[model samples]
Target chain A: MMGLNKKDTSLFVVVIVLALLAPFFLNPFPTDSSMAQFNAGYPDLMQRFVIFGIFAVGFNILFGLTGYLSFGHAAFLGVGSYAAVWIFKLLTYNVLPAIMLSVIMAGIFALLIGYVSLRRSGIYFSILTLAFAQMSFALAYSVLSNPKFNLTNGETGLQVYANDPQWLHRDSLPDLPHLFGLSMRSTYEMTVGGWSFSFNTGYYLCAVILILTFYLSIRLFRSPFGMMLRAVKSNQQRMNYTGLNSRPYTLAAFVISGMYAGLAGGLLAAMDPLAGAERMQWTASGEVVLMTILGGAGTLIGPILGAGFIKYFENIFSKINDNILHQWFAFMPDGIEDFIVAVIHPFIGKGWHLTLGLMFMMVVIFLPGGLVEGGQRLARLLRRKKSDESPSADTKPAE
Target chain B: MGILEIKNVGKRFGGLQALSDVNLSVQENSVHAIIGPNGAGKSTLLNCLVGKLIPDTGSVTFQGQSLLGRHPHEINQMGVARVFQTPEIFGDLDVMENVMIPCFARRDGSFRMHAFETVMNEKELVEKAEQILIDVNMIDKRHMHSASLSRGDKRRLEMAMCLVQEPKLLLLDEPTAGMARADTNNTIDLLKEIKEKRDITMAIIEHDMHVVFSLAERITVLAQGTPLVEETPENIKGHPKVREAYLGEAQV
Candidate 1:
């Protein structure tokens, strides 16, 4: 309530409830059922959902509020991941320090990049960010992978080894990333009848972080700074004449979003304890953009929904092979089933990217407000219909 | 010395000389009007005053400080506010928000990190913005999106935005460029009321003789990127060079 009005407070509560109940909601299908393949309650995938949700939320701060699309957010995320891994190797296996270090490191990187990139706006700003991210990726891949430094560890990725210093680590504890003694990989499973739900310590940690960041995002969206950023998006010219210097506002938003990406990246490494240079690649940046836009750029919940939708399709849809398709279509006539499979084949499996593109196109064309707008429209229509019928019936009784 | 002084100001855009040897001085607490035909460099000169463009020659001094090389927002902080030919209110914000931005600037200087502060909770700013809205006769439409306002209301809102800042020097670029006669009259009345209520200096550029003759205490006529005459309204109306510039012929 500090920054949120009633509506925003309700939205925040709804997000908290949804996140807390995700293990049950996402794993609705029974383990023995054929539909279990679609279940997203597993530790790894659930962790990704929350992690990328954090990524998109951070991205929306800059893109949604200020309308400054930086195509290099993944660089911050990658730096965050690398920082977390280094903390694991030298400091300790405890994730709190690693995550803290990652966020700070990422903020520093973002400050440097935002300072230079914010000088030129529109497409020029985007290009500058893109160039900086590419340079970071190249440096991480080759230049930082020398025998003298070996910072990123080249293509094989950077991971904690048994021989690393880990000066703060105790010999009595397990060599995995943890919060004190609680292992990130620890899980608790519950079974009821034929259904089972497994909740991971790591996934819950990510979920809790995601919820906090989401709340912070809501606060940012409703704050005066948020209004200034929107003003920057609306008309920078008017802002200047109104006696506002837009550069510092835009730069702050950029750095804040970058820190969010870094937190997400740190979480990624905290879950798996590895950092890859590919995480900083431009495609990863594009993927987060897609998540933000596909979910709805300006809305709070749209990005999380978009990220979940894409990751779900990527993991589950791609697992559907010809044999699985054939199994599903076994009841049909041979020729027709084969034809149906052929038509559906290209858009699923390895063609999930194509499906993602098609879905993105349709969303942009029809639901430009993303899924959130679509939901609002549908709710309005339903309310209109209900009100229309009730009012007509009441008028008939009066007549 | 006048509050704002322009000395030998000249600017060229490649082949076109926009303003050449344009010298002008705006006295404190006086209404000055800059009237000229198309491409007479009125806009070019105004742009120079506000830091939108740097003059090739001469310096623009406000309160004896050079306005050259200062950013637009810097000039604004130095008690100079500008209203564009077309209203430049923040289109995405509500009318109240549009007014409150300038109020924030007035209170907070050019920039401040009020990121965590709830705008709704800023009681002082809200009251200031609402008072300005009432003064501008837009209190009823405070919640409306600025872009959706009628042209007259948008112009009124822009004026309110500028007035909220309590700027020392208010530069208006054709404040009534496109308006119905009644709306233009309303704007004139509003400007008159503001001038009466505040010790503010105004420099207006206009093509409307009604607006210029009604509001300006002093008038400067620019012709072919040069100031042809600077005189009081009565003297400007009877000036031979002014009549020649408008009628395209010198009268005996």
Candidate 2:
């Protein structure tokens, strides 16, 4: 099963099936029905889901396995996006080169940043990364967007323009972000009974990348290098005395994860040919942290689950307005109905952060292992119930 | 010359001199013990050998190469392995994995990506690690998490981790400190077995006289950051200086 052991192979298969069938699975409601707003089968959001899933998976390599909390991952992501867009501007609208350059550029930046930041550990390491990300953000926003030499193109963002020298661009190729003639935003709509689904070229591309990257991450987790990273988290003193340098191990992880972030960022730019300074902001860095923890930090599938969970919630929850809340609570008495809507209002729409905050806190406090732990507990409970129904449990003494 | 040599080593921390004018050498294939009471600079001397602390004066050399200014990992790569007072096994890793770490470090220098190959695929390393586990009588607990093991088991795991490296010089800092009498005896037997089977040189620092007398071929008594006497266990037994250092404890 793709060189993975039994458990990892099964998990990989599950993820692959989910990624390929996301459009159908996400659009579980009729298009004209009231639940249509909850449907997340659209191409744009689906691409985001896989892209951020890749980001969290990469971040977990450093933060989850090595216990190095980096707060500047978005800098690499932003750097990737900028590199991709520059490729579009300088070379062509084709995404292949953009994605490749993005990874390489991000790797170079990560080498520099990681070499400096990895000198410290714990909160100081986190602060060092956060400071670097903020500096990158500030530079991208103002300093690098100068009139004489514009690298980031300032607050307006860097985008492909008609006047730009896209030397490789031709009349036959699609002007939009694409692989050759295949446009990224091109979608095929199919209706089965009351349900409608969109299978997008871009989402599938992102899905393929996600699946490949996810498999690579699994290999990393099972490799000797992965074991070393875990040792870095467990006991650095033991690791050092065993003739292994913790610094190089962590730096390599940092660079590798940075490249993953770059891959994700390139995908984002490929989906939409614009790289904005906001993409490099600290909030964006923090979002991936939330995704990794909310799902499970060290587990292979946890980050993907977490990314999907946070992105899905962010989309659907933010769409809910006061009107929607009032409609849902209309069955109650007049005063109680208003109170119910008022209570729910703060958790939806513009107040989505409150909900995310609450969920993050609950995950950290009760489910320290995150959503994966919750799923494991459920599986254990179900197993217990099944065993209890059988005579073997009562007849057998507890081990 | 000895495998590891300390020439007039000195170390200071703020207002206090932790160790000063210390000179000693651990001969090849012998168990050398540095025994002293609390705050007697025994641990500081061990730290200097393992690269944890750099002496302000004099040199610490291993196999004729200076151990000074080198990182712990670099020193370890030069065939010097250390076991801590408290069993500093990788607590989060399982038993077999804990032992295999030093094996990996031994096989693959200070750093290697090894990003793709599965650990199980390295049959050679796994077999070597398992063999060491067998030698330590811990093959049955190979799959168990190191943290869940009893203190005695943890110490054994730590010992296995060091021994798998087959270092030229093995530094043990109070290897049986805080152990129950039965556990201490087991450790002594383990050390004796290890000595019988290997060509390794051991440097042990202990406060327990029973442990020192049981394993040490040579004993160095330290008092107030200076060596009082360096002698064999038979000669150190009735030495007046040893008696004074131990406050007339008949156990010496």
Candidate 3:
């Protein structure tokens, strides 16, 4: 059971099954059907789901367990992406080295940031992290992108160019990222009863890494170190008095989470072969925080669910247009349909963020534990009904 | 030599001297009680011992090592455990977890990377934690969230947390500060039982005369950041300096 308890083992198995069958399950709608646009089986989007899942899972280690809200995680992610892209430019186009280098680089960055930021706790800690991230973003955007010695390529982003020296790469090899000639973009397509499913090699690779990291995260969540982190969150004063140091534990959690973000960023570069300074923005950092909180902060599965939920809404909801809305509501009376569309228009399409904001507010107010708590509440209610009927069933048999 | 020694430890905050030339010694395996009126520097002295504050002058040492510049956890690792005035148990953790943390700290020192070791797999730690909980008479409530415990139970749990460390020196700041008579007596009895069974030194600061008289082997009365008298409980009761400093009245 990979050191997991029975319940966690089962949950792990369920996630494996879900990830394995995602292509088939996600592409449920026929190609020509009106609901085809809702299908999320595309390679690009699926890659995003697992990549961000890794990011949030790492974030949960720090914020969920240690209760240190880092407002600059995206800086590590950005650093990872830049490291990955630089690896692609100077070294071979193979993703393994790029991914490894990105993780290491991000870990180093996180260690520096965490060391300074952890000296302060509460909102002061958060502000310090934010300041560091902003400084990193500014460096990447301008200072590091000077013409004489450009590390990042300014606004155009860092990418592989034909003239760049890739020492490990042969001229005959394809320029795109690959695993021993199996191109990351390679996909296998199948059509069954007018429904098409596409399985991309890159997506599967990311999915496998995500599952491994998720398993590691689960182990960490149940470990003694995890308990120590929780104790830090609960009462740091007591932790210190109990002969436990809080700084090293918090810093370790920070570095681990930062590495996760780096892995995610490396995967992003592997998929697109570009690293942008925009990835380091505070808004990007806020998105991951929203994902962690909206799913449930402390729970193992909550962050993944939150990341997927937000990304799905971001992609699918933004695709909605007035014409599509009008077509869906055509069955209703013209006046009523127009009125409904007008009312709903602002919350969809480009305004999908408004809907996300509203949902986040609702979750914070009604379900402080996030969607996981909501699911648990539902499960409890169902269990209660089953228990209530069991006694009645026994009485009926006696009668 | 005593296990803990403080010599001429003075701390000044602006114009007011919080603690001025305060000297105290705590012997091994003895219970020393420090009693003081409000703003009498008892807390400041305790903070200095636990490395929460740096005295402006003089040295505070435990086992012949200076504790002046050490961090709180480092001070704790040197065999000093502190109990706060209000119970400082981890409210979010269970009772068992609250006790187990100190056991981990004791076994692993200040910090160890036990990130991958499942807590359930730590059989020895679990046994040790359970044994301490049993000693504290809280084994039955081990699974309960610590925050749900009554005030007295919280105090017991906090004491259990400190005791699990098996610290050589225990610093308790008013262990029964806000408790009723019954709870106070329960705490006193628990401390008495702990003292009987363990070869530990304790430094207790208290306002309650009943608790001080019942538990302390040596008593120090502090007034306006200076020790008025250091004597056995029987002698401290009739000492004129203590009576005047405490009651503002001259002995007849």
Best by lDDT: 2
Q: Which stretches of candidate 1 lie over 4 Å from their true place?
A: A392-399, B250-252
Q: Residue by residue across A20-51, what tens digits does model 1's lDDT show?
A: 88999999899999888888899999999999
Per-residue alpha-carbon lDDT of candidate 2 for residues B101-180, written as tens digits (9 for 90 to 100): 89999999999999999988899999999999999999999989899999999999999999999988889999998999
Q: Which candidate number would show the highest DockQ if scored against the true structure?
A: 2
Among residues 3 or more apart in sequence or in different chains, the pairs in candidate 2 whose N, CA or C atoms overlap within 3 Å are: none
- Please, what are the lDDT tens digits per residue for candidate 3 over residues A191-301? 888999999999999999998998999899889899999999999999988878899999999999999999999999998899999999999999999999999999999
- What does candidate 1's lDDT look like per residue over B1-252, in tens digits? 999999999999999998999999999999999998888999999999998999999999999999999999999999999999999989988998899889888999877878777888899999999999999999999989899999999999999999999999999999999899999999999999999999999999999999999999999999999999999999988888888888888556
TM for every model, in the order presented, reads 0.97, 0.98, 0.97
Give the fraction of true interface contacts kept by model 1: 0.74
Decoy 1 TM-score against native: 0.97
Chain A (alone) TM-scores for all candidate structures:
0.97, 0.97, 0.97
Candidate 1 docking band: medium
- Clash pairs of candidate 1? none
* Candidate 1, residue B163: how far the Cα is off, in Å: 1.0
